[model samples]
Target: MMRFVQGKTALLVSAIMTAMLLTACDGDDGQMGSKGDSGVDGASGNNGLSALVSVTPLAVGHAQCAFGGQQIDTGLDTNSNGVLEMSEVDSNQTQTICNVTQNTLAVDLVGRYQSGVYGLSAAEIVDYHPLSQSAFVVNAQSGKVDVLDLSTLTQTAVQDEAGYSLNNIAKKTELNISVDTGLTLLGAVNSVSVSGNLLAAAVERGDALGNATQGNGIVAFYRLSESALPVYLSFVEVGALPDNVTFSPDGSVLLVAGEGEPNSAYDVDPEGSVALIAIEGGVPATTATVIDFKDFNIGGTRNSELNPLIKINGPGASVAQDLEPEYISVSADSQFAYVSLQENNAIAVIDIATATVKRIIALGLKDFGLDANKIDASDKDDAINLQAYEGVYGMYQPDTIASYRWNNTDFIVTANEGDARDYDGFSEEARAEDLNLDPNHPQFAAAQDKTQLGRLKVTTSMGDENNDGLMDKIVAYGGRSFSIWTAEGQQVFDSGSDFERITAALLAMNFNNNNDENKGDSRSDDKGPEPEALAIGQIGSHTYAFIGLERTGGFMIYDITNPFAVSFVDYVRNRNFDADFAIDTDTGEVEGDASLAGDLGPEGMKFIASQYSPTGLPLLLIGNEVSGTTVVYQLRLQ
Candidate 1:
């Protein structure tokens, strides 16, 4: 059995940070800028790979991320409006836009799941496959990797999310049925990567159930076959709690972000660092290298307080206090690695070659949306002032990083939801969760701050108003659904338009009500926004993003090509039929929800150009976070 992390929410933290590692061509291709004072110079980073800028400009092939999926557990709403206007498949919305017709894809987290309709959960499916033929989905509640093969006509699982809560997976093709050691760690699977057939997993230390921690603090490996159990490899001890795992572009080196032994508690080493696991001659379990972030920043006290802010429960009452590495994603070329320091509210960048600290980029700023010179409330409050913030985690928690790559450059985007901190879900004795978990408990009134999270508006682009590279205007939105921002964190588009429609929907839906800022005796003054489901991909150069409102149905689209004037274009409702499998289980026929013509249930999206039309068309990969499984749809000009 697996044990829960010490704190309320222990996650992999990866904030946004972009850097490129290049080399001098034999000749002077002055085309590239002067190599400035080269820092972290070494082959530690997987060279040959270029940094990605945006997720536009598709690559050839019938499949450009063929489909998409997302698990809705966190904040999907923006404006804190209390309605589920985002879609039809939303939890509270009885009407659905899923199975309107035949041969369609729509999944409801609960509706489609209870009957074993679709094999998925509310906290599942974290990534897509590099081969584009499979989805490396994870059942976070359980260490299971649902390797769903999208190649054939039916939904046959190659690997179910059973054995472990498979956080990450890597395929090393070099092992032709060799290096077979089937040893596996329970919660250690934080991240995974493939380096020339060597599958590396960054395992978290500490026995979750034990009062005393017990993790080796290393980057471990497992050999594999297209089938059969995995082969055991070796481990390289690095920092405290190593949470994120990724291979450099060339697959030569492995970049790992350590949470410092206590992935969610205090760091045992006090040295926040990343480890480099080298793969020499394609052999498994080679030597490992370490890069210390504290070592570099220690040059002066100006940076002391910046050491990742870890969560603590008084001195040592066993209440669980630890720092954690939420997520880590490397450049396509493997030159730079981005790690999310969730507890610390920071993003750490690693230069593979030199195995040195590049820079630590902070996430969120309280005053992101405030006009630089405006005399606004957010500007005046010392509490909300945001200056490329690293967040105050006494309670408020941030998480998740969705990266978008354009051209050769890449960018890491972060999602800051509430939870992960102790908000009592809005209660006085919330730490006494048993009381707070009670929806009808009288003490529930004391628990008022449900909207613990908000968009980190970080920019001023007309399109990116209050730009944090995300649509902050949605803060006025009810139901925390998906919001699209420009590559530069500008306001791109929100699944729901104005607060009226959005809140009306959120309130009607009755989802995450305690999270409403409108409640009395709250932490932050009422901003009045409803919450929704989590969003997956808004990559490709498309018109908008399709959103999934838990019950209102699973489909909401945003016109993003034009950041300014970005509006709600489509929405789907509760006409769902495709929740469990690709095949229509209801009538044994294809179930297509045409209700999505105008406004429909569009939970999440993967951009794709329509075959018939040459212009950019988007494919809406829809799924219900609470009731059903998932569905796929195609979108066009209204």
Candidate 2:
């Protein structure tokens, strides 16, 4: 109930009562009348029928805000004008509302789209065009992006007596990345991003023989239409293996992460880099500013500045080549970009205005010895056994990352989905039991048994610090959790074991299940749940972080309005646990009822605010790689 602050009626009544007492006392000549028993306080007025709120976007350089925040105006509709006017606003309530926490938000699966192709990357990365009311999804299996029309997508449109059709939604068109570009080779679209009426796609280059090539990639541009496929504009050549791409918030720049992954034979290695393309007049510049990491190479100027904890383990590869930039996130002001170096377990800060590397912050290891950082370290155990091994640690090898502002300060969020350098020519991975542990180390006997810590995968390069052949400390691949970090890469909060604990309690039967197959406890030895995809959104002053669990087939939401005081909000999974969706032993293929399997292996996620949503409600779009499906969920606030 909204109370009004007014003094007209109450103050007038008190004034008249005082006048009557003064008149009565005047007749007694300098004698004051006794206060007749303090009169009872009048009852408060009823609340107004409705309280209205209006939000206006603030511009840059505002003295009272950072990165141009929202200006909120709230008032009671006294005149019933159906809009909050300046005169109706209460003077006492005029303020800039910031970070009001709420826990009433939930998500409901409203629509889904299936691409028929299973076990292939039919849908990997997804981006939406608000004006077009469509989603541009990266279909790596078909070498194109499948466009799905969401203008008519509704709960009723997708529902029927026999349930919804596998192909309920309509595929508007296929956006082939190689459409207008003249140069042709084995190409694959890795990522896509949309801003306003423009769309950008990152395409990786391959050798003519269809093998992975160590050559420069390309970032293609297009013009989004209201009811048709994107019109190709132009393409700019970037670094090797452009894995991820995104546009700055202001649409002034486009950034691409050149992963520069080496071939399986380890024959050629390219230097990882970032490309900054200036977007002018709705088209990319003729060339891009390529920012390479050569300064951090061995014996280079910045070589001595390297952090000791940053991993540089690639065989015969310089620091430039070993530091692979997997993902990119730009600050709200578009002044800087944070590039996640997954293999190196670090993040590179790039000054956008200067197009130069400002610094590289190394993400430290997570000590599992702490009680809060426990893990279920065995798939062969056949049960959820969460324990803390004293000598074990986890690398915060983040795959996808994002940036947000809280209280006008920037913070970064990462999905600590660890990766290993396992290839045909070089492999640094081994099961815990396969390696010989130091006899004097704690939990040494437990590491030797398959049902305990033996099944966990660990990197072989770091444990033997003394080069004594016997491992001293076990360093695992991924952190198995998400973390909030300062702009300088200092970890502020880590959801240690929350993912495992929540999944174990809610999905005990399907604990640690793999995405392709429904075998419980299979991924426990590997990265549990593998939080890869991430997106941040704001609803009614509260900010939320949505993390996608790649293996377990769902997403988790957390209240991140206060990064230091984060809390779990909701967990939703659409996969059918009862369905027998397992890989075939003979063909090594996932064969089961595709319709019942639901969405699996969420590779990419995008959040749409209410204003840009088709239904005028917040929505989340996810692209599931293994199941080859794209699903949509509407945010429902109670």
Model 2 agreement with the true structure over 392-480: per-residue lDDT tens digits: 99999999999999888889999999999998878889998877789988978888888888889999877886888998888898898
TM-score of 1: 0.47
Model 2 regions more than 4 Å off: 1-103, 155-167, 208-210, 583-589
User: For each predicted model, how many residue pairs clash, with residues at least 3 apart or on different chains?
Assistant: 180, 0
**lDDT, candidate 2, residue 36?**
59
Clashing pairs in 2: none
Model 1 Cα lDDT, one tens digit per residue, 151-263? 23122111321211211223222221112223234342444455544656554444445512244455556554444444556666665556556666576777676655332
Scored by lDDT, model 2 comes in at: 0.82
Candidate number achieving the greatest TM-score relative to the actual structure: 2
